[model samples]
Target chain A: MREPAPRSYRAPSTALVPAVELRGLVKTYDEGELSVPVLRGIDLCIEPGEFVSLRGPSGSGKSTLLNILGCLDRPTAGRYVLGGTDVSALTREEQAWVRLHHIGFVFQSFHLLPDATAAENVVLPLFYAGVRRAERERRARELLERVGLAHRFDHVPSRLSGGERQRVAIARALACRPRLLLADEPTGALDSRTGASILELLLDLHRRERLTIVLVTHDPGVAEAASRRIFMRDGRIEDDARA
Target chain B: MAARVLRRHPGRTLLTVLGLAIGVGAFIAMVSFAEGARRSVVRQFETLGTNLLRVRPGSRARAEGVRPAMPLSDADVRLLRREATTLALVVPVARRTLAVTTEAGRVHRTRVDGTEPDYARIAGLRFAAGGMFDATDLGTSNRVCVLGVTVARALFGERDPLGERVRIGPALPARVVGVVAAQGRTTTGSDLDDFVLVPRTTFALFLGATEGYSSLEVRPRSAALFEAARHELTTLLRRSHGLGPAEPDDFTLWSPEDTIRAAEETSRILGALLAAIAAISLLVGGIGIMNIQLVSVSERTHEIGIRAAIGGSPAQILRQFLAEALLLALVGATAGVLLGVGSSWIVAHAMQWPPSVSWRVVALSAGFGTVVGVLFGYVPARRAARLDPIVALRRE
Candidate 1:
């Protein structure tokens, strides 16, 4: 049996410069002496202002890849460059700083702080950015209104509707004016109509603010709506289709 | 910010503050008692006179439960009069308790201090009324007695005790020419309040023939000469008593300085013991703070996680918890200080013990409370700081 050749990573065209690039990314976890690889040699590029959707079945390394791109986890072996910074070379605090300053995350479960109001949740990124209180509040209010939740600014996560909560999460991700927005099943918890509304809001933000978006979903409609779609299978990219 | 934090968790804050107050209050109370004792000892010594020394008896051998004294013969007295250079006055005195009757027909027990006119000067005693006995009174073995303030008040019924005749043992009439000033109770609560003074010659003639004195009291001219006077008098007595250098003297000498030093030393030991006990409570209070802080960390795990995720550094988280802990301890310490100081004052005023408030004690206890807060609160604060922001945020 002949061994397979190593996959080559293609760098995106540098016209606008890629917002996120991963070369030979690998992530492994150890259970005692056993090493379980979740992401194996993932090579991907997301260009500035491009809406990309990553589609895969459960346990196919899609979320793991997203985590690496968001600077939440270090790859076991690989190079990750985001916003012209070699993220793999940065220390933990530096990585957190990068994530805080440049990347915004939206979770499938709508992870807004339960104790804080919608506006307060939106101000979280600015808090990490060390923005002064007055400025943070101003920006938070503006983003809340942008998401059509201006009247629900004082509503806590528990009080907000599913769509309202997801909108707040989106507003929070844009708080520090991050360059890239990563939404993991942004409409997973909402009804169809609300899900379509959230999807439309994300598309509107991506086009208007020139923000790069990477949406992780198993839904075909969500993936098809993106400007580019990447399909993953068994910890490897199966296909890349551009719209 | 401090006020806001405190207000946010009022119950925990108040509980912590209470613990500190109890610790501080215990410290203040213990220290005050010890301070009062020290003052009492000083007062006793001061009343006995600063320049005076008491030379009492001892044995050639260590005899347990035995009374010993150098025989104060007339010749010994004459020898002291001639050889003593540092002695401003040397009065041979004796003490015996006697039953006496007054003209008012009251019989009471009293201390009979036998001494000459200069005895009053040496003992730091002053006449509250009338006049003390003179050398002429001692020479004639005058049956003149001086009533102490307590004795006079008890026997005379608010009447003038001066020139009144009092009957001692065998109904011998001793005229009270002077009233000795009242001396309050000492630390041991002893009865130095009621006593009577008379000439040594009178004591020997009327009561019993005493060839030996109980003690020889020496008063040096100045404090500087006290040691010299003691040394000189010891040498003179040793030579007169025919004691060799190899043998222990038959008498022991006591002075205000020695008594004062001993009192101070014992007081210090007692104070330390009390402080140690109080410190144990403080330690317990510290443990209480630690326990409460640990519970707080657990209760606010989600809050801590959120703060950290939102850009609160480990340092900031640590500081916030520590601040809350300190706030609790500080409140407790403040309350304790007030209670301790106030109780000390009340006890002092009520019992007439010198209630001395030591500022150093208050400052030390407050600082101690703060230190305890920081020390005990650190482990929990660190635990809170080390929480994974992701897990914390994910937690309900």
Candidate 2:
């Protein structure tokens, strides 16, 4: 006799809270007797699955703001709430843990380890997150497949193309399945055609995974792909526009 | 990741390891040379009778500048042979550092040791060929000689010097009766195996016109009799020389105990000096590691930044760099030890000196190398650890 369709065991998904909440964020760098303020009172909130772009010219502190938002850098004074934890006052290790668990960053240069293969690069964040080896490999392969670089899993950065490298970088950012994705000019290093393709791939993933993305870029064309854009100048917000 | 990183830089890593190996090899060789010299000296000293005691005229201070030989009259030898109870054998020996010529045109400046057949037992001479001079030869003052291996080789050259006669003084001829085995060279100043042994009476008749006897060797029955023999000999010499009770004795007696003490003091000083010289290589090796570490940090700036950015704390960065530095040093040290040992072997073979390979020296040298690495490499590793990830990633 034909058995009834097996019951699917599924976990519950609860819309808990906003992904990130920043209040009066300030970051000042000490340059050997000179104190340069990079961010002055940045107040912003990103909801779950929102694609927000930070746009500005060079020396506008957009990168600094993105760094703080990504938890890669800490503000001199601020209250940052990320994934239910107040992370601004956290120790470097705690901040790293938050970054490891709740956030992921993608740099403009596709900063994949040169000595590692594409799959290995993707699995790096999971390594720090204390994931089991077999599970990390499984996730790494799945992410590579999602980024359409499954065939190039074993290829090193040196052997990969610019677009391929960025895809690997994106795949790495998603290894921990972070709540907030921070892409700092992820397409800047690629040609226009390849950049567009990469952006499309990012948009597709954003839609499929419903992942919150905060993309930083100087290019309006790149910024246009996001649902919203925040313009910055001289370490202050100048304008904010929604698509 | 480390394995992959190393694999990627195979050439660089190999070159680094090779450089370390060279350093280690050199360290081993030099240490071996010094050790070999030490062993050679000890072996030579061992050939001199361990139970033998030497008596010479002078105080310790005076002995340092110029050594005056102990003079023994014919009456003194007769008295010691008849009256000395604690001594096994006491023979008056006069050694003059003089150049002797052979009819074959070979001239060598060597010691002419004058003693009787008892000299063999007193001086610990093991004859390789023929026989030592008996009491009859000494009584009649026969011009018979026993040549050392080196002297024999130089004078006779592959042919036996036994049954041959060679010139001692200008016209004085002595017959070579026996050839003593080459005991080897001494690290000590004295050339014990580079001399000829002749009858004591003959030496006194030929070379002892100005002095009665230059030195006297006394062999005690055992270690127990050494003190008694020394005391009795001292009193006898003082009395025979007619010294007053207030006057200092003219002769200084040197036993195995004294030789050992002197050797210990000298070895301590020599060991420190040699160790210092060897330690300098460790310093050089450490500096090499430091310089390489600094270069490595700079070379892998982007890599360090990436590691830091990817959840690696400062301590981890520090550990990674330090590990690389330590690994380099440890490899170099191992190489140095092997090199040191191998080089010592080569030196021993080339010089034909008894090589002594001290495990302590190897361990000490290796330890020093390791310390040098950590001390010097820490600065660079710290610099790498403290590298601002932002600046580092941005660094070209």
Q: What is the fnat score of candidate 1?
A: 0.09
Best by DockQ: 2
lDDT on C-alpha atoms for all candidate structures: 0.80, 0.77
Supply the global lDDT for candidate 2.
0.77
Error of 1 at B43 (Å): 4.4
Tens digits of lDDT, candidate 2, B268-383? 57766766665665566677777777888998899887766766666667877787777777777787777778877877887778767778767766777777777887999999
User: Worst 10-residue stretch by lDDT in candidate 2 chain A?
Assistant: A1-10
Question: Which residue pairs collide in model 2, if any?
Answer: B24-B336, B28-B340, B29-B340, B41-B187, B69-B214, B70-B214
Which portions of model 1 miss their true places by more than 4 Å? A1-15, A108-172, A185-204, A217-231, A239-243, B1-36, B60-75, B99-108, B126-128, B140-144, B152-177, B180-182, B205-211, B240-246, B271-291, B325-357
| DockQ scores for all predicted structures | 0.13, 0.24
- Root-mean-square deviation (CA) per prediction: 6.7, 6.2
Worst lDDT 10-window in candidate 1 chain A? A1-10
